[model samples]
Target: MDTITHTLFGLGIYKAINKENMSKREKQTLLFTAIGASQIPDIDVISQLWDTSGQYQMWHRGITHSLFLVPVWALLFFILNFFIFRLKSWRFFWIALLAVFIHDTSDVFNAWGTGYLEPFSNARLTFGTIPIIDFVIWFIFLLAFILSKKGSYKESSIYRISWIMIALHIIIQSIQGYALYKQYEPRYEQLALSASFLPWNYSVIGKDENTVDIIQDSLLTQKHLMYKLQSSDNSNLKKLFKQNPKAQTLYKWSPFVVVVDNEERLGIYDPRFYRKGQSFLFEFIEKTQK
Candidate 1:
């Protein structure tokens, strides 16, 4: 998920806590624990400064976002709260753990995925059932926030209900996405699904041999073929990978790539992100004259 969605998750978690008898300082500390831990995993973005090997793609959501690091992040936040706020309650540690866990787990549903197992496994566990920015989730949070302000009900109760709604939305979307994936399972040797920003819609990328198909589909609508891309699967990519290290990284990082070998260039791009006649995740080297 994106930064904004994660921040909202933090706020939702904080709001769900019953703070009726807590001191003002405790409330402030809890707020910090919730929001800080929610964002801490993304700290891996700084690796770009030292990323000379073009491994930034693998490092951005790498070990820092691992489940193994969740407890460490929680402990760090607990210690920070102790020194800064002079609070020693274990509640801070537990809250921080939940916040960080939610952050790491939520990212798996998006197409970009994360290294959830980390050192134990390097797989990018992506479901692609949820978009990076889900408007339905935003709407749930907004509705809960608005209702909390207007009703006589406790704010915690409102936020808790919102979390339930959010969970149900994810469940429904994932089931639909999984069904679509299974439907295309037999047709392609490799497949990837990316949920559309609009609900119940998806972009399905299926690669069979050297031909890649991108289909725009929905549970209720007829499947539309968006693009048919040809990949030069038989071409030797050694020169391309040697010339552009990022190309090598991209080739390994993506589930599959549409390889381009032509007079103009040698390139590879992930079909899942292809748009407007090009893909943002493409890596290429121009042909050199002899």
Candidate 2:
């Protein structure tokens, strides 16, 4: 998910807690614990600055977002809270754990995925059932905030109900996406899904040999072929990889790529992000003129 969505998740978690009886200082510390842990996993983005091998694609959502690191992040936050706020309650640790756990787990639902298992496994586990920026989740949080201000309900109760609604939305979306995936599973050797901004809509990418197809469909609508691409699997990418390391990293990082070997260049691009006449993730090297 994007930074804004993650930050909202942090605030939502903080608001869900019943802090009416807590001291002002305790509330401040709790808020920090929730938001801080939520944003901590994304610290891996800094690896780009030191990435000379073009492995930034694999390193961005790498080990730091692993489930194994959740407890470590929580512990760090717990200790920081102790020193800064002079508070030693285990509640901080538990809250931080929940925040970090949610941060790691939620990322798996997006197409970007994460290295959830990390050292145990290097797979980019992605469901692609949820968009990186889910307006539904934002709406839920906004509704809860408005209800807390306008209605007589307690703020904590409102936020808790919002969380429940968000979970239900994810569950429903995932179920639909899974069904859609299975519906088209038999047609291709490899398949990947990407959710649209609107709920219940998805873009499905399927590869059969060197042919790639991008179809937009939903349970309610018939499949529409958006783009059909051909991959130059026969082309030797050894020189391409040797010349541009990032291209090799991209080839490995993506679930699948549409290889381009034409008169002008040799390149590969992720079909999942195809738009207009090109893909944003495309990398290529122009041929030297004779």
Candidate 3:
């Protein structure tokens, strides 16, 4: 999910684990650890450069987000943060691992989901459980996590209670995801087979539920009904094209007063920026001043 929820999740888990166990120093460490642990998996963003063929979606999330990497990364932090991390205590290790795990767990809800069981399976799972960023959760958790750290509140119950709330909130989102998923059938838009658009497995466009509208930048839009072939005969195909206004729209873009083919499907295209394979990256070469 969004970094905010991820952070809250980390904080809640920290408080839950540290219940009655935090030293003044440990308490301070726990709060910072919680903040970092939650937001860190997003370290994957750096792989945006390595997104060639969108393999980063599969490969990057595959290794770094794995269960095996947890202790390895934790150890890296433990060693690096030697002064900050009280590694002599076993509890600190447990809380640190929990913080990272919670961050990964929160990812199951976002659009750009991750591979949790990586190295085992390549499933990029998601529930579309919540908007990546929810301002209310961000605001409330922001205040709660910060206040607890700033005031150095030592109360263990407050931390436990916060974790309970976090669990309940995630459970509610889980139910919403299921209910929304069941409301309608998903119609995967069939692009013209030759669409230069590199295909992701399936691009679902039609809504499965009326109540939920997927929100992104407002520039995002989609159409449900598209021009289609009505018959196999060229005579009928030509008639159909003449009847449909959208066909005229597509033809307008072509200067080749072209011969049209009836067997082929026509499609609209969009220019999208994507990451190149790890070694190569997208760099726009500017034209000389004209």
What is the per-residue lDDT of model 1 for residues 1-290, given as tens digits with 9 covering 90 to 100? 99999999999999999999999999999999999999999999999999898899999888999999999999999999999999999999999999999999999988898999998998888999999999999999999999999978999999999999999999999999999999999999999999999999999999999899999998899999999999999999999888888999889889899999999999999888889999999999999832
Candidate 3 lDDT by residue in tens digits, 103-205? 6766655444567777676565555454556554555455566667776665345566556665676576556444434433344221111011211111222
Off by over 4 Å in 2: none
Model 1: lDDT of residue 141: 98
Ranking by lDDT: 1, 2, 3
Candidate 3, residue 49: the lDDT equals: 80
Candidate 1's displacement at residue 288, Å, is 3.0
Off by over 4 Å in 3: 12-24, 48-60, 81-86, 139-155, 185-290
Candidate 1 stretches greater than 4 Å from native: none
> Between candidates 1 and 2, which one is better according to lDDT?
1
Q: Candidate 3 — what's its lDDT?
A: 0.47
**Least lDDT summed over 10 consecutive residues: which range in candidate 3?**
191-200
The CA lDDT of each predicted structure is 0.94, 0.93, 0.47
How would you encode candidate 2's per-residue C-alpha lDDT over 64-115 as one tens digit per residue? 9999999999999989999999999999999999999999999999898999
Give the best candidate by lDDT.
1
Better of 2 and 3 by lDDT: 2
TM-score of 2: 0.98
Candidate 3 similarity to native, TM-score = 0.55
